[model samples]
Target: MTDQTDGGRRLSTQEAARVLGVKPATVYAYVSRGQLTSRRDPAGRGSSFDAAEVADLARRSRREAAAPAGGELSVRTALTLIEPDRYYLRGVDAVALASRYRYEEVAEWLWTGKLAPGAVFTAPPEALAAAGRAVAALPEHSGPIDRLRVAVAAAAVADPLRFDLSEEAVLGSARCLIPTLVGALPEKAAPSWPGDGRISRRLWSRLTAREPDPDALAVLDLALSLLVDHDLAASTLAVRVAASARAHPYAAVSAGLGALEGPLHGAAGRLAHRMLREVLEQGSAAPVVAEYLRAGRRVPGLGHRLYRAEDPRATALFARLEELPHAAPALTAAREVATTMARQRDLHPNVDLALAVLTVSSDMPPESGETIFAISRTAGWIAHALEEYQAPPLRMRPTGHYEGPTPPQPLP
Candidate 1:
């Protein structure tokens, strides 16, 4: 058994097969049957079972050589990698990766099978000009995300080649849309040398306001990388469902953004931001937090569905924030509030809370909070769309139960 500390390493089925003196196909069968545990590699290949877990499985199998009636098994479409507990991309901890790389680069890696490669740097002038028009068309009061949503949809429409979700078209759209969403015409492109190893981090910094103080942009880049994908989150599920209708990536992703815009999925950032604003405006983070507890309102960005301890992504962001030069009084206040709230209510900060503080600390425009989340999430949306396109069709159909006495007197 490998030590528990070998967190990211994996042995191939061929290698494990040699260890077990079995065929490689048999090893792969062990994985599909869940009799062996394995993980995806950086190249998207699922390497063979964990030595420790596989040993355990072998032990149990040997002990129970002939039994079949103890437990039931079922086939599942959740094979889409939607399980919250173990979901990841290329063995990179999704949450950990979010805090480890840049937003643009993360999207690129997930889509085109490369990490931090240079964007197809020469977007047609027409594309940029069309994006500018989309920008101009937005109401001045609309926030960055709203503008992005509109612009992306517009770009897809204007392209006329959008239905071509051929591998080439999908990849190109992803590359162009990534930058366009992060920054419009005037936003500076980060100084990433093509194929530069740190291009993802550099691009992340570019998305921040012109003068981000604590290097929150860097922290955000890492966070985005981790969060950029989750197997089939509700919004991602929406994208997949829409894709089952033969929707292209753009159409699918647009549907995803709509689902994300809902409160339960996309609006956590806004919730946290509003809570923090109330705390700052009222001169105390306590009463506001306490009232929420008293009212049973969900404390925005505290608990997470997958993480039980502190969310690793939140921990990573907070750790890097200590050295930020652009720290605000409210950011400090919010942290203290977070600490106090934790002790007082046993609640801890979640990703949204951390990001809310970051947005405030960055002096970003108010709407920028949701905008950033959506922007980071675009990668996930696109990824889910691609996955759906590759998957078997129409599995999302829901069955309806007959009710109300079989439609009553309709036959009369």
Candidate 2:
């Protein structure tokens, strides 16, 4: 039940309790509140998630993932989303919001749970340093998301206050790490957080040296808002598991960060990027898609686990990109490729694919896109962590097989 969860370590309910310094029953509360994620094993029993992501969530929320409550603690849950579910930001669908608002405004809506009618951004020391580290650590050939994975992992290690889960530090990491990572990914020199203003409280603020074009910023904000939450992403589940253990926010956030490093979570963006590139190069989506179907592999960046409507974020970005002046040939080419999918195929654009083109067009640094996502997503993770912190820990236990005990009674 140790707190650290790296390289895909999953924890059960009882195990989670040991890490959080609480009983297993409290962990159950976390599950009921949508703070934790789990899966159904073959036996129809649900298994809890890894604790690392929960700890990571704690770090950004300015609170522990799970704290004392009525003499009980949260517990791990065993549930699954057979399909992806629709996500929202500030009560708006991602696509509609992106189309109508600026990135700054959108971020505010997500963080505050209100559509604050103003710009949104953040620029904290941690955000700045972490963003740079993400880009610097990338292999020369890596894409935005891959670099982000490495950067996030490294940032967790580099934080001077890695174990401090105070409100100041957690909020500080949310503001600083996000913007800095966005700025540094483009191979730029070190970035300094803006001294004052609302932007100072934002993760996206410092990522751009100049004032963001209102339109582009709006789109990004919308995208960020949309991506701010999901039912129980693998990494997010990790966040709740840590809360079940009563790990501090930073520790839970570290766990979440580790989960994001896995291919299933953080790497989805890279898949979208690669798929778009392939489609553009082929100059025909049909053959490219056909090939995948032949191999019986599902297409990336096409259908989603949730959302009967095309991903609103994707639609907004694609529509907006279409409107941009003299959009680059690569972007135009990518859109042509995306359109080839059937509308009824229920195939739609997702945030990842749209971001691939948007980041390139923004001329942001190589890994800036993925780094930004980590920064942006921290907000949602933090929110979930805070919710977890209010609950008590839970306990979990299961029977162990003893078939061989009698036969192996001889002492060594």
Candidate 3:
């Protein structure tokens, strides 16, 4: 017995092959591929393998073979890398960037690969007017995302050079497009604070009728920064597909906005908001949370597929909110929900729960979080679009395997 074989006895090649249900050659192949670790005996015996690694790999292999499409297939991306519990944007710590930098800064970094301190984000007045008109033309019950889609379309029509897919031209278009989208949404009042012209404050005005608190404004900015890009999210993938076809930046972002409307993606924030509101109104989380569990319903904002530990983005935002007095109640409710879910199912809250808490605690509209998600994700979409434009056209097409009924005869 050795102390290093996952705290148990190591196995020789023959024994390991037996446990793995494979021949000795297969065991050596596993070692060659780095799937199993093997150590040589000090007394000149043959290589010994870690039993636990062999067992784990056997289980994983079976599960993967039985799984359907989209099972841990690696897609090469230089934009973002998602690790066990945290994500990096172009090799930068996203959580660190969110905490210290504004959304504008993060966007610049993602789109241009540099965070210029003196960089400016400005929208053309004519485009802003066009966005306003487009938003006003929508139905009264339309959500912010609907307005965003209309605004992008309008911007596309207004910009004659929108077809220029060059990087320089695309960067200019994206910078104008983001603020214009924010400006197009309904705002209760004009910028009242000193730096109210900033997109975060402008967006804050549009999201709520209340006076903008500095702390809340900071949280909103951080939220935007945190969400700017998340590898290849559903929305980002949609944007990339469009861009691969040489679609304009506006059209690419529109594709992303369309995917963002799906419930399992960007719109998850609204569902989470509803659940948290119920908890806040009832004065306790147990009853409402328990009812969802008993009914076999998925508890929104409770779990994430990519993160095994606490979501770093959620943690960063919650830590910021802890310093703000006004966010206490909402934070408390979020904690209760988190604790309850972990106790019951051992699941952790993801970025959605953090977003819900931000909106509810700060008294933003129910749809505010989704709006933030769309706007922030716009930066990511554009980054992906830029990347895709340089790739071979139509390279993402997958060949379909025919599983339908066989033909009776050949064109009789």
Candidate 4:
């Protein structure tokens, strides 16, 4: 094939692919991502790409090695951008949104491209009854998140039209889902939700036995919004992988919960919460911090993969904690623990620390942080499931190269 030049040296898709030492699809991906400049064919037959840009991209792609953990799998997502210190959810500043918006509002924005004004979400009475039965039927010692898992399963069973994958249908389910999940937690008294029935208000009633205060409730709200999503986390990936199998949205969220059961992901805050409680009870963080370090265990909630400095979410939550008079002891203990970690190990606290502090300050259940994380992440799981549903099914299958002993020849 003859190469074509339009003013500058331009290459057709095939020629550009050859120059870049990549496939035609990769060339298109580069063009779509704006890594390569392309224009319509002057002859109106095929597309033309800038040869110089193609060459430059080729050089850069060659120098870049595959990321160690991901096996060189490149996933293109427009949902979240994770930087060293901050992240954006669909181009909105996530930290700022956490402070300025309600959890449900942010969840709607994440699920749908546009935020709907005057949106209100209420759980269906029967679905709530189903979820409540599921939660109450569990063992008395069942954790908050366990109740949530059962509730999700029950909700899915109750929804007859859950197989529908249309945007309107999925969003409709999610609108009820948040409330149903929150309502499923065992109520401490009559009318478990005493406030305006916002998710934050309902969630507070579920997690704590004590009455709610505005300061504590504000912290929980911010915590939920901040934890709503991070790009391709382990749990989020699990959700996407499930959705790629064409699983219903509820099933996809269940998959996310399964992955989040691990300590490294969802339960990290529980560990931090325990340690913070120890500090508050002992009236000093020095011995607890020293013992944790001496055991050669990295302090949980002190570091994160995506931030070199302090986590922006943690910073925002910690700032809000300063205004609560009742949280003074817990806040001081958290501050001491953070200062000790930073001074001794040069590591900064992540959002888990702030979450633990919030739980302790509000006198919520010790496992409440994990529950908040799971609930907040449900929005992200649903959003990812929606995105995956639009793609070809089972697209996330991974092939493994043989590294074991060769098998015997087949008996013919």
Q: Is candidate 1 or candidate 3 better by lDDT?
A: 3
Cα lDDT, all candidates: 0.62, 0.57, 0.83, 0.83
Residues 273-366, candidate 2: write the lDDT tens digits: 6665676677767787778778987666665656775665567667767655534654765566567666436576666767777655665443
Q: Please provide, for model 4 over 37-121, each residue's C-alpha lDDT reduced to its tens digit, 9 standing for 90 to 100.
A: 7788667868888777778876665444223244665555778999888999999999998798888889989988687664667
Per-model TM values vs. the true structure: 0.70, 0.60, 0.80, 0.82
Comparing 2 with 4 on lDDT, the higher-scoring candidate is 4
Model 3: weakest 10-residue lDDT segment is 65-74
Report the number of clashing residue pairs per model. 14, 69, 0, 0
> Any idea what lDDT model 3 has?
0.83
Task: Flag the better candidate by TM-score, 1 or 4.
Answer: 4
List the candidate 3 regions with Cα displacement exceeding 4 Å.
Answer: 1-74, 194-196, 408-412
Off by over 4 Å in 2: 1-86, 90-169, 183-214, 328-346, 360-369, 394-412
Error of 4 at 381 (Å): 0.6
lDDT of 4: 0.83
Q: Identify the runs in model 1 with alpha carbons over 4 angstroms from their true place.
A: 1-87, 95-100, 112-123, 184-210, 281-283, 294-296, 328-331, 343-345, 402-405, 410-412
Report the C-alpha displacement of residue 412, candidate 4, in angstroms. 18
